[model samples]
Target: MLSNTIFNTIQKISFIKRTKFYNFCKEIIFPFIVTNISKLFKDDIDEKLIVMGAFGGGAFVDNSKYLFEFLNERSDYKLVWIAKLNHVAEVIRKKGYKVVSTYSLKAIKLLRSAKFIFMTHGHMDLLPIRFSPKTTKILTFHGTPIKRVDFNIKEAFMYNGWGDYFRLKLKNNQYIDYVLTHSGNKIEHDVLSKQLLISSKKILPLGYPRNDILLCKEKEFTEELKKKYNISEGIERIILYAPTFRSNLIVKFEISKQELNRLNKLLNELNSLFLIKGHMVSEKIDFNDQKSIKLLDKSADIQELLIISDLLITDYSSVQLDFLLTLKPVILFPYDYDEYYRTKGLNYDLEEIAGGPIVYTTEDLIDTIRNIDNIDYKFKEKRIMLRERFNKYVDDKSTERVLDFFNIKYRA
Candidate 1:
């Protein structure tokens, strides 16, 4: 109880002030804990079971979604998920599965016992599972790279900040067994290898399992989602606007009333429904009063929404890569391009690879949407080239390839 209170108080202190304290913990406290962990807990590790954690259990819609479903169907293995919030655990429980709290003793035992541990993100919540000595760690990686990642910059990662104490010194990813990747793009694969500090041999070029759903023609699912979202009878098409999560920039771009009015008018003229999905970390803007636009929260399934969207609008987001699998039109809205480039450092040129018109403002966005039919055809070849370069195995057999690596026979 006292330790928790002290840690909470320390967290409230500014990051700069708390650096020395975390460094002390890393140098002195960590070794003592690691050496004595066996004395604190007594349980034989279970090799058959696989344990997984992601985004602190806010949503189960990433790589874990497919892996969980796969493991759940196989009665031979036990799958345990660790969530920070009880409500998040409850949602998983209702899915006919088991979930343990991040701070629970059960989670500790599972972490110590599990043979395989998979994490989608490398945040602090995953520390316990990630550091487990016996487990074979695999990261499905949350998204395709757009901005320069932590591991890519050695000075920023290892020397410049206190973040290195947590990300590198304590949870050293050197022990990672494998990291997933998509094939055909040598540049992307090389960048991922360098970013992870893992050998290229350990990086599997298996296509992302999450993208497999986009390749299917789920007419019934699409109809059901439309009904669930309350789309009007006359809506001809749906345009999905999903932006990538930015660490430094939290506030999303807001539209003025005039711009909103114009957007609504254009949607009416195009006979389209505009669905806006903000980054998971973003606060929802009040668009409830707007009749033509539907605001989707973090809980919404982005893949399902992408399936129904006729066009996609984004800025520096990897969702553009995922949407390309559908051979649909996309518009790049880099309103803060200079600011973003300075801070996050994009790997590729936005205009060069956008596969459609790269708009700098909301006015350009509206204009592009108004003339999308011609724009789609104009960028058709570019989109195909980008798709071939990034996605080598478009046949949707990525999940099977991953399972095959572990010698797990997939019956399907």
Candidate 2:
């Protein structure tokens, strides 16, 4: 705990990242150590072996999780999940899946010998490791980009200086062999290629594995979710409010008890349950004993929640694009639009991409929810158009397509 506190304190010092000593350690010393350590292992790539991880192996969620599930069901391939946290490993173990600790000797051996290593965030998902040149590293990015990412964002380049940026770029190019996207559109391809520092050819528009569940109607999963959340059968609707992470770590919402009570009353009157799922990095909003309002687990698989939701309320999140596939009602609540735009930046203006009502205040948000039926009807065409622009594939066969692309045969 003391060591962790010290590390956290050092990380909070902004100038440390810009120091010459830090750059030497991060860009030079770290890679050198990883490379030398990796050399100790043989480059024996197992064609049937695939290792996967996400969110630095702290949680099992995202495109990698779905892909892991698909492969786990098959008999031909040897699948393993690399978990950095013991609890995460235990959870995967409870599901009767093979999971190894990221720092374990078994994990290092698996990573070095695996033919394919799949990740959602980055290579760090299986941190402090290096892969064989014969191994293929595939990045199934967490979401469709609505905000700037990686080196594409100005802050990333300016924060660490050009030398550090180039070093990071070189590392990314060396590590990631391929990246997956939801669509084949030129703009999408270009954005990913630029942000990820990889060639356009390496960006495969094979669709996202997580979106597969969203396209298909999973009644069993819905029932499972209902039981897990203890949601009653009498509930008419489930409205999910998921907001993207803010750089400042502030939640720009009315979280006062009075306001929460009012929102809860509105949800109760509509026979609906309002759920708030904040981004992993975002500040948590206190629901404050409101019976109709619930705060979802931060590490929950949101794709499953999206499956059971009647409506989605979000602000500047790529989740809006995923929810559009459901052809359901969405309410955009960008209360801090100007401030967010200035600090974090967005790829496209909200008005240009929003397929539903855009409300700015708590009162407006409540009013919009009250009249959601009409709003849903009004945005039908717009939603379809936006969905097509964002997601090219609308079927539940993305996992199959991914397997086919990789030529991984599964028994029927």
Candidate 3:
């Protein structure tokens, strides 16, 4: 099996090397042909509207939509449009904003005219995307950056999909105009502003602005989503298993199967709703569901679900920490934990970080749930220690605070 696995690895690299290298180079070379060196910051910071040269998948897409709308209503510095995918770009376009694709010729042209370039916890690394300092790049790091993301460089450089498309395995030393982060918690060890090292002017904390909606009750939205997906009623409890992908050592885009009978069997036994929101780069799993257990490809409204979910099952996912802010239960299912930790890595120990149960097998996870009521004393202790540090706001002004820091001046 080991020999066959080695041969398969070689075969996969050989196949990707055959055609994708040239295509990948095309994407890298696109920067030169994009907007000229001087054009990135040319339009005098068009306050009438801001232009974000965006990337990444859903998190970025979702947050940008809200930001775009907020900016349009209150200030002249709206993110007028984005060079992004349809889900977010389309909605903003519908709001009378332009939504263009990023990296392609069309994207490049959009950036040429763009006065402000921004990325929000998205996948599009600004290293290759950086054309000029005048462009004014704003990076709103979605989650706290984990300590170890790259597992094997040699193995990664040899592949296509697993490397650059997901993690920014490359190093970027460029200084951003502003880094709008979920502050209140120290990004570095500084925890607060005065002891900072990086440009103190740019390290503005805005609480987690996007989680505003997540903190609310979107029952209608949930019902609509459930109805649209034809999800059956009688779901007593909803649990989201969001696992963060480790780098090359952790195969993010792995092939998975629909455990139809297994899933149903478990659902019948446990009587709960389970959602497998695979990491952004993770491969798809299609298990057409009847009533019991349903595996989703991905859902755009994850924050909404996060609000409704009773418990969260995760593995090295920052979402677990995010969910903790809601004062809920979280469980771990680190199936490839050792391999993931050795290869890619974590900021801190998972056991140390989580305030909840660390369970692996399905039975173990179910058992944790069964005994969830009694676990609050331990979780609350961690929450009390970490809450003030991580969350600055006990209310709904995170987005407003962020926009204010950007000097965008949008209304609440």
Candidate of highest TM-score: 2
Candidates, ranked, lDDT: 2, 1, 3
Worst 10 residues of 2 by lDDT: 151-160
- Per lDDT, the best of the predicted structures is 2
> What's each prediction's TM-score?
0.86, 0.88, 0.75
Off by over 4 Å in 1: 1-43, 123-125, 129-134, 151-172, 249-251
Q: lDDT of candidate 3 vs native?
A: 0.55
Model 1 alpha-carbon miss at residue 351, Å: 2.7
Poorest 10 consecutive residues of model 3 by lDDT?
189-198
Give Cα distance to truth, residue 323, candidate 3, Å: 1.0
Off by over 4 Å in 2: 1-31, 150-170, 248-253, 281-285
Angstrom error of the Cα, residue 381, model 2: value is: 0.3
- State the TM-score for model 3: 0.75
Per-residue lDDT of 102-190 in model 3, one digit per residue for the tens? 43444544444555666664224322443444555666555554444333323324443543454322222233566655545555334
Error of model 1, residue 132, in angstroms: 5.0
Clash counts for the predictions, in order: 0, 0, 4
Estimate the overall C-alpha local distance difference test score of candidate 1: 0.72
Return the candidate ranking by TM-score, descending: 2, 1, 3
